[model samples]
Target: MARVKKPKAMNAQEKLTFLLSLVPFLIERERVSVAEVAEHFGVDAEQIREAVRLIAVSGVPGETSTYQYEDLFDIAWDDFEDNDQIVLTNQVALDDSPRFSAREAAALIAGLQYLSALPENADRTAVASLMTKLSRGASAQPSQLAVEDTGSDATLALIRQSVTAGTQLEFDYLGARGTRERRRVDPLRVESMDADWYLRGWDHLREAVRTFRLDRISNPRVSEQPISHSAGDVVLPDTLFESSAEDLVVTVEVTNSAAALLADYIPDGAAREQLEGRVRTTVRVSHYHGLKRLMAGMSGVATVVEPAEARRVVAEWAAAGAARYDGDAS
Candidate 1:
């Protein structure tokens, strides 16, 4: 019998509750969807659903018993003549920074401190310095932080422009496999997730909506395609990553010599365990090649026990590696 593994991430309910706590601010300021809120907060779809529940029930008092959704926040569906979905209307803006608790302040400062570990040339140094600027109470200055300006793909800037003017775009895309492809797309909407920029659009070729990493595209021809973007359009979850598969779950047996080293490559691999100097670790990963590289890197530290295919893949790679150095230098 196999042991059930612990989750490395927050589940739906917990995430939803934490997110709902922020709703009063968004509602008071501008409209937003549960998915957008979830994406920004780094939570899951189920979590977003809960946020929607809060949004549905959330409002000041209505004139009648039934509350007006528009009066509370901008909310609606898109593609009624086409699809089933929900969306937020109107351009949203942050009313202001929320009041930070003492702990939140400290954590925020600590985050800026961590960003300072990046290379010196990062443009965000100006932004990171805001930590000290906004946080007057901090005693000392944090180290200089930096990041690369990943080729001005025009994220929030263009998003605002396109959404305002209802423009279209044509661009060359660099895909995940390092292939360059061209896409003449209908620019529907745009949003940022965890600082990464994304463009939500209708890909004519796929006959469905898709998202492209802003930085990965260049010379986007704008509004050339004759496509009308309906109001209240929201990007769906699957379009974000493009892959239709669950994270690979692999269980490995790594006794005395190596159990601790399993973490260097696995998702949130830092989790620890002890079992008679032998540990059984389970890893959740999406990329199979990455897992192969990790197994090869471990050398002899951990032995993969489950998912016969995973072990076979790693063994083949190791065998090929051995053949490369077989009977060579002394």
Candidate 2:
């Protein structure tokens, strides 16, 4: 016969902490086996049984300095003695505990919905289960919330498939410089910021790690050539946009409300200044070719404050866009 090792003894403080935690655990599950609770807490089954005995007699003293029967915790004695199950029938002062508000639950549910959209989070069952629990547990009814599809599910699915298969991916990518080229890359990691999805991969053409926006990728095809490099094989930059000596440093002034939207564009320890309700900060980009689109996206909330060339590029691009609607009645 094999000898069973006893669990190490816990001191007074440890026992108190265990008892405090055990109350909520039993309350949440309504019923749990002593063996299961012991496994969860990493203790012996006998320890859990002892804690239950302690909890049943513990309670806050009444005004007369006496503990009333109703004021103390109570458990189902029949199940505990027969099946070794723990069930709390009478709880003390826990009904007054704070719970998630309707607004808070709605916000959390919205975030979970966004998480469910990612290709990596393919297990809809877990996310759905959590959302249901939040809805039911909230103090009030949470407002209905939904995440709109980004219309890049197909591209995201393909990239995820390539990454799992350790295969190289081929795609016609429209670069930030407004040039389109075919690229072959070893799929590495897929990430998202705000509403956009990006793929970080080892670019064979550039012989370096490059980040590609999912929306700009077209004609994606998975190649049979096995991935030659993984994320661990390369030193990826903390930021998606890798800085280079040739990167053009342009200063821009943006409204205070929209400054947070430029987090990825701003480099670490970059020069920044606040004047009234606007801020002036330096941002880096591969070239000024992409500056026009950035300025347009801000919709007059941002402006290139310096670098005669960058300002000229944006102005010229805007002028051309306006020319398209020249003399149009509609």
Candidate 3:
């Protein structure tokens, strides 16, 4: 039989932190076995019991400067002492705290559903269970909510497999310069920005960390070559698109309400100014084609303001798109 290792003894600060966290856990479940709580916290049952005893006597003092019976935390003494079970008979201030509203619960459930659909999240039992728990714990019944899958399952699955096996991935990538090139990368992290999925990895061709949009990837395959670098080996930027000295600084004008949409493109400490009623901001892009695609999505709400090259690219892209429909109109 395998012997269980004992948990390290917690210091005074750690014990106090543990007790504070324990109250919420006990309140959420209403009742739980001492052994179960011990396992959840990876501590011995006796430690949990000691913590509970301390919590029972701990509470806010009344106007008289003495802790009253109602002011202190209370537990079902009979159940605790006899059955080795915990039940909070009385909670001091938490009872008056607000719970999640139906709308809030629905939004959270929707996010969990999105995570459940991701290829990286293989074990979805926890997510499904949490969704159910949120519904039961909400202030009111949440409305039905669903997230449409972006149809990148096959690509995402291959990427997940490569990352798990510590292998390299080879794919035909559509570059920001409108060029398709076969590239190999050591898969590191897969993340999402807005509705699009992106892969951040060490690109063998560039010999540096690069980000690739999933929509631009084609003919992806897991290579036999093992990954040369791991996430810990390199510094991954907090923002998806990390700006470099070589990046083009393009200025754009957008309405006040739509300015928030360019947050990812606008680097930290970048320039922003309010001109007339619109907000003008500078965004970094590796190539002009990337700006073209960005402006296409914003259409009437955004316009390229400077760097003549960026405006030219957007105008030519729009003109080319309009030209295609000209023949169809006849």
Candidate 4:
């Protein structure tokens, strides 16, 4: 291979990484603009094709494709100095999220390695096999998972340390009820439940063990706090995963205009039926805030049709709003 003048910046490996990460996305969209690739990846459209070209030829070669064969991709790149286009000859049924996230690759490998390290005596042979697939890219990568990185690493460090030490913790907690107050909590453990991190600890103010979202905590501090109480009393709900049994069950009767927006906002699982003009919809949400906000945003377009408490809550909130600004309550 001769010394090819590389693009202004980006090494072969970097380019390869960028290209592979994108193959899945382009594959999903099936075909995409060269401009989108350039704008998103911060690389030239030509460079992206160079990556696609690499993908086109990547696979085992064979008669059709045996062992070192690279003819699977029929990627055709069209160059227009003013506007460019790219076409994929094949489907992108592959996981490409890792290509976008270099750290995720390491996290991916580390997580697998951690689980794979479990002993055969642990009876996780099946799990071990799945972990291997994860490392090798069994499932496709997803779009970016939203993460709000708090400036303070101390909060994270505190939670991890408290779990390790089995010590209690103290912090001012903001409850899901939108009521803010201070509390001394017994840090039972921390868990990533439902894509959000939560402290599965004993919230003292509530006189009960409640899951507090890690992000909601402020001034998190680990204490020499002694607690003789076992976490046996702080049990998570058994119905936590039962979607059918434990959905919010919100019902909405809406007119034509609002009905269209309802489909975008409320999920089908929560929404019930669609008839000629109006639809009766229901949602099974663990909490009311999400549904409350949805109804609030819908304003006059839709009506909350079920659950007397839900109706009362919305009415109360509306009344509160009316009093706050001395606005029209009628």
Among all candidates shown, the one with the greatest lDDT: 3
In candidate 2, position 82 carries an lDDT of 99
> Worst lDDT window (10 residues) for model 2?
114-123
RMSD of each: 23.0, 6.0, 8.0, 16.4
Per-model TM-score on C-alpha atoms: 0.34, 0.65, 0.59, 0.38
Clashing pairs in 3: none
User: How well does model 2 score by local distance difference test?
Assistant: 0.85
Give all candidates' CA lDDT scores.
0.58, 0.85, 0.88, 0.61
**Model 4 residue 183 distance off true place after TM-score fit, in angstroms:** 1.7
User: Which digits, one per residue and each the tens of the lDDT, describe model 2 over residues 1-330?
Assistant: 999998899999988888889888898799899999999999999989989998999887767888998778899999999999999998775744587999999999999987765545658899999999888678899999886666577777677778778899999999876789999999777787655789888999999888899999999998999999987788777777777898889999999999987887888899889988999999888888756657777977898988998988888898888988985746
Q: Lowest-lDDT window of 10 residues in candidate 3?
A: 114-123
Tens-digit per-residue lDDT, 1-330, candidate 1: 999654346578865667556655454434455556666766665655655555555555445756564345445545211232335442122222355555556667666654443322145667566775545433333334333444543444444455445665677888655778888666665555445667777777666777787878877655644455533454465334443246677877676676545543344543445667677767765556756756765666677777989989888888887887885642
Better of 2 and 3 by lDDT: 3
- Candidate 3 to truth, TM: 0.59
TM-score of 1: 0.34
How many clashing residue pairs appear in each of the predictions shown?
A: 7, 0, 0, 23
Q: Name the candidate, 1 or 4, with the larger TM-score value.
A: 4
